[model samples]
Target: MSDIKVISTENAPAAIGPYVQGKIVNGLLFASGQIPLVPATGAMVEGGIAEQARQALSNVKALVEAAGSDLSKVIKTTCFLKDINDFAAFNAVYAEFFNAPAPARSCVGGIDLPKGALCEIEVIAAV
Candidate 1:
């Protein structure tokens, strides 16, 4: 295998640690877990899971677009939440983006998240 190409975009939150926003390998785009952190100010979005999920997905949207793909091209997504009880609220927001024939997905509850954010998302998409 060749080196993994790092993917990044101003439209998405900048990598806060030692990770790239996403990577391309073997014609697939693998995105890092995107929290609701706003790239422009490096701050978490206001509100709870719904707003947080929205920002994170919107950020994912930007990353996919930057990689010459879009949400329709997404094949799978993994979601993380600080509280499982917020699942319903999160789904409400997520549904607006995925629409019908949604991509394969899985969500898990966690103890904590970066910047005290409520949710995070990562995606794999065709390229």
Candidate 2:
């Protein structure tokens, strides 16, 4: 059987739906898509794309760390954006969290996100 473990952390926003924060299997951490909801308040953050992106990435970072990994160890990321025009702005914020040798990524636009968030981010990392 596959050895899969669920990853959870109070530092990040709890899952809004019926899902865990992340999963670890075979030394890899697969994190769920994180929106800009404040962990403590469970409220969507208010701001432009940059601010929202920062919060989303921060949530991702928290979950990654909770899984015994860090942003530097991320292998891939899938991002969802409500508006394509915010790509540049989102990238600017995303760059702040991920350093050089950044993980492979895919960002899609025009997707309706939960809680009307500007963006959401999910990642995979080495644990």
Compose the digit string of candidate 2's lDDT tens values, residues 32-82. Answer: 999999999999888889889999999999999999888999999999999
Candidate lDDT values, in order: 0.91, 0.94
lDDT of 1 by residue, 72-98 (tens): 889999999999999999999999999
Residue runs of model 1 more than 4 Å from their true location after superposition: none
Off by over 4 Å in 2: none
Choose the strongest candidate by lDDT: 2
The collision pairs in model 2 are: none
TM-score of each predicted structure versus truth = 0.95, 0.98
lDDT against true structure, model 2: 0.94
Q: Which pairs clash in model 1?
A: none
